[model samples]
Target: MKIALIAHDEKKKDMIQFTTAYSPILKSHQLYATGTTGALISKKTGLPVHKVKSGPLGGDQQIGAKVANNEIDIVIFFKDPLTAQPHEPDISALMRLCDVYLIPLATNMATAEVMVKGLEHGDLSWREIVKEQEGNDI
Candidate 1:
């Protein structure tokens, strides 16, 4: 499974903690993340991550493209709702793509915890079926 990890500036600490705590479950799969978030997670947890641009600098759009292509299976974005984001449109597009593609997305820690656990238990194996169907269509 390919998992995307993103976080707002204010929520970066939380994202780091979450990744560190779940490193055991996360290390088995591919990990993708936005710039600073990816750097931090990699530094703290030593998990190899494919890093894209900073979210404000088009990382969200990059991830959205992956979702559209069915290359991403899960998204864990720890957004800071209290703070207004300058790149709101990009964020919205990424989230909308997740919905359109039926990818699992977690906007908060609680939801992320559940999704990570689900991944550990193979609950997300359905993504492979979806990918196979996509290939057949192609």
Candidate 2:
């Protein structure tokens, strides 16, 4: 499975913690993240992560493009609901793409934890079927 990790500045610490806790399960999959978050995750967990630009610098859109291409199966975005984001439109577009692609998305820690565990237990194997079907359409 391909998983994308993203977080607001306020939630970067939480994202780090989540990645660290799930490193064992996560290491087996391809990981992608926005700039700073990807660097921190790689440095702290020693897990290989493909890094894109910072979210405000178009990383969110980059990931959304992959989602639209059916290249990413899961997205874990730690949003800071209370704070205002300068790139709110980009974030909204990313979430919408996840919906459009039927890709699983977790916007908070609680949902992310459940999704990660589900990923470990093969609950998301349906993604492969979706990908296969997408290929057939092309």
Give the least accurate 10-residue stretch of model 1, judged by summed lDDT: 129-138
Report clashes for each candidate as comma-separated counts: 0, 0
- For 62-107, candidate 2 gives per-residue lDDT tens digits of 9999999888999999999999999999999999999988999999
Against the true structure, candidate 1 reaches a TM-score of 0.98
After aligning candidate 1 to the native by TM-score, how far in Å is the CA of 123 from where it should be?
Answer: 0.5
lDDT of 1 by residue, 1-138 (tens): 999999999999999999999999999999999999999999999999999999999999999999998889999999999999999999999999999889999999999999999999999999999889878997
RMSD in Å for model 2: 0.7
Stretches > 4 Å off in candidate 1: none
